[model samples]
Structures are given as structure tokens and as C-alpha cells.
Target: MFVAEAAGLDAIAATGTLRVPRTIAHGISGEQGYLVLEYLELGSRGKADLLGERLAALHRCTADQFGFAGDNFIGTTLQPNARTNDWVGFWRRHRLGFQLRLAARNGYGGRLQSLGEQLLGALPAFFAGYSPQPSLLHGDLWSGNHGFLADGTPAIFDPAAYYGDRECDLAMTELFGGFPESFYAAYRAIWPLDPGYATRRDLYNLYHILNHANLFSGGYTTQAEQMMQKLLIAHS
Candidate 1:
């Protein structure tokens, strides 16, 4: 777990867009995984525009295909990132399919499971005209995953990093609302997203929501169902 985290940090830092903590050491300590990182004295929020622009540049980091060289974890859940040339295939199998299957095995059944299966079947329609090349992403970019150093450098940590749709990162930014208008504005100025992002955002986010449902069991299962319902309606 810690090793994968260090690798993700290195990948993001390679982009030289946002700040990433240097992984000093990583190892396993008697049934526990640990990653030691260079501690940064975090301060208040940094410039939103800079964060947005840097994140956009980071997303420009590309790959020959979707997925990492190996599997990693998103939170405690195992995230398989085995390489695939087909973007939708990667998202369907390694992403939504993996999460939904896990959820089902954990006894989450009925409507949420059914709706997720339907959405998985309809995945092709979501990418009808979109042929997205794999882009490096801070796969879990919620509000808590980012901050600023005392020197005002924007640092994002605890990434579930992958080479996939850039919108996945942007979609998670909107999930919890730490990002500001200047952030979106700066990002658009650098790499403008496709017009279909607004429609596809929910589809991307549903993976996270499904994972959350399996992990924490809040109202997330319901949320996933609702999102899929809307998506299925649109596709229909």
C-alpha cells in the first residue's frame, strides 16, 4: 500500500505542476504498510488559479494506454490498474466493474447492483465521440487530499493516481467544493475540456460513490443508484 502511494507521489511530481511530497522511505512493518514522506509545514490555501493551472498541466501527462504498470488501492479498496489500450474497457472492467462486483460480494444488492450493471452495459454510449488518450490523474482529488505549504506552494497528497480521463480529477474537485471559480477559469485557459464533460462527470464520479458505498455505507449506495438512473435516462 505504502509503496504504491510513493509511486503515485513520484508520478505526480514528475509532472512538475503541483507540489508533491518527496517519499523518503517506504516499507512494511509487521502486517502494516508505511510510507515516510518529507514533511511540509502546511499553511492556508494557496492561489486557486495556480492550483487549477498546475492541475491542468499535470493532467496533460499522458500514457500509451490506460492503467498503471500494476494495481493500487483507492482508500482501502483494491484498484486494479492493469494496462489496456481501450479507455472505456479500462474504466468498465478495472473501475466500475471491480467496484460494483466488490459491492455485490459484500451483500449490497437489488437496485444499486442492477442499476450499476445497466450503466456498465451502456458505457459505450457515454464515449460515443470521445476518444480520450490516457492522462495522468490524481484519481482521488477530494478537498482533503490537497493543501498548501507554508511557502504557499500547492501540494496534493494521498492520490489514487492513474493514467485515464483527466475529467475524473476535475469531477472529484467539484464533489466537495474546496475549488474556486479562479481554479476552473485557469484550467480552462490552459486545457479546455470537451463539451460532454458535464454529462459524463456523474458517470466518472459514480465509481467513487460506489466505492464509498462499499467502504463506509452512508447514503452512497442510494446516491450511486440516483446518478445511474439519471445517466440511463439520458442514454435512453
Candidate 2:
């Protein structure tokens, strides 16, 4: 696990725009995996604009397909990265379908499952006019995962990195509240988001909510239902 995470950081830094902690070492000892990274003193706050611009720059790095070259983790959950050309197909099979199947195995069913099916069937409608290209993503860009270093350099870490719709990273930033308007503005200035991103943002976020429901409490299931309802209503 630690080796995978360290490799993810290395992958992000390879983009040449973002700053990530250098991976010093990684190995598994006994039942535990260990990774050694360069120690960084994070400042009290991050420069949101810089991070956003840098994030946009990172997203500019594109991929030929809608998954990573290899699989990685998202909050310790197994995230598969089998490659596919179709964007919607990739999300349906990998993101939404994968999570829903896991939830069913974990004994979450009924309305959540029903609504999830309906939403999954309508996934194509969500991207009726928008054709997304594969781009490098932090995979988990929540507020807690990024900040400025002691030297005031913008640094982002703890990534579940992959090649997918850049909007996935953008949507997760909104899930938590640490990013500033300047950050968003900077991102837009670099790569303007397509129209309908507002509603599709909920669709993108549902992946996380569903994952949360599987990983934690039933509250996330409720939230996922609400997100599904919103999408259905919008389509209707």
C-alpha cells in the first residue's frame, strides 16, 4: 500500500507542474507496508490560487485512455485502472458499477440499489453533449490532502492518482471546503470547464458518496440518493 502511494506521488510530480513530496523509500515489513517520504513542514494555509492553477496545469497532461496504466487506491479502497477508450463506459463500469457492486455485497440494497441502477442507466444522458477527454487527476483532492509547504511552495499529496476526467478532481475539491475562489478562478483561466459541469458535478461526486456509504455509515447512502434524485429531476 505504501509503495503504491509513494509511486502515485512520483507520478504526480512527473507532470512537472505540481509539487509532491519526494519518495525516499518504500517496503513492506511483516504485515505492515511502509513508505518514507521527504518530510515537509506544511504552512498554516495553502495558496489556493497557486494550487488551483497548478492543478489545472496538471490536468492539462492528458492520457490516451480513461484509466491509469496501473491500478491504485482511493482512501485505501482498491481502485482498478483497466484501460478503456469510452469515457462514459469507463465511469459506468469502473467508478459507479464497481462501487454499487461492493455496496450490494456489503448488504446495502433496496432504494439505494434501485436508485443507483436508474442513475447508472441514465449515465449517458448526463454527458449528452459533453465529450470528456482523459486527463491526469489527483484522484483525491480534498482540502485535507493539499497545502502550502513551509517555504510557501504549493504542495499536494496523498493522491489516488489516475487518468480520468479532470472534472472529477474539480468536483472533489468542492466536496470539502478549503479551496478559495482564486483557486477556482485560476483553474478556469487555465482550462475553462464545459457547460453543464454544475449538474454533472453532482454525478461525479456521487461516486465518492457511494464509496463513503460503502466505507462508513448509512448517511452517505442517503446523500447518494439525494444526488440521484437531483440528477433524475434535472434529466426529467
Q: At residue 34, give the lDDT of candidate 1.
A: 85
lDDT of each: 0.89, 0.87
Span of ten consecutive residues with least summed lDDT in model 1:
40-49
For model 2, the stretches where C-alpha displacement exceeds 4 angstroms are none
Q: Against the true structure, whose lDDT is highest? A: 1
Candidate 1 C-alpha lDDT tens digits along 103-183 = 999899999889888999999999988998899999999888888876667889998899999999999998876488988
Q: Per-residue lDDT for 9 in model 1?
A: 94
Instruction: Supply candidate 2's per-residue lDDT for 30.
Output: 100
Model 2 local distance difference test score: 0.87
TM-score of each: 0.97, 0.96
Candidate 1 segments exceeding 4 Å error = none
Mind giving the per-residue lDDT tens digits that candidate 2 earns over 60-129? 8988888887788888678888899998988998998999999899888998889889988999998988
Clashing pairs in 1: none
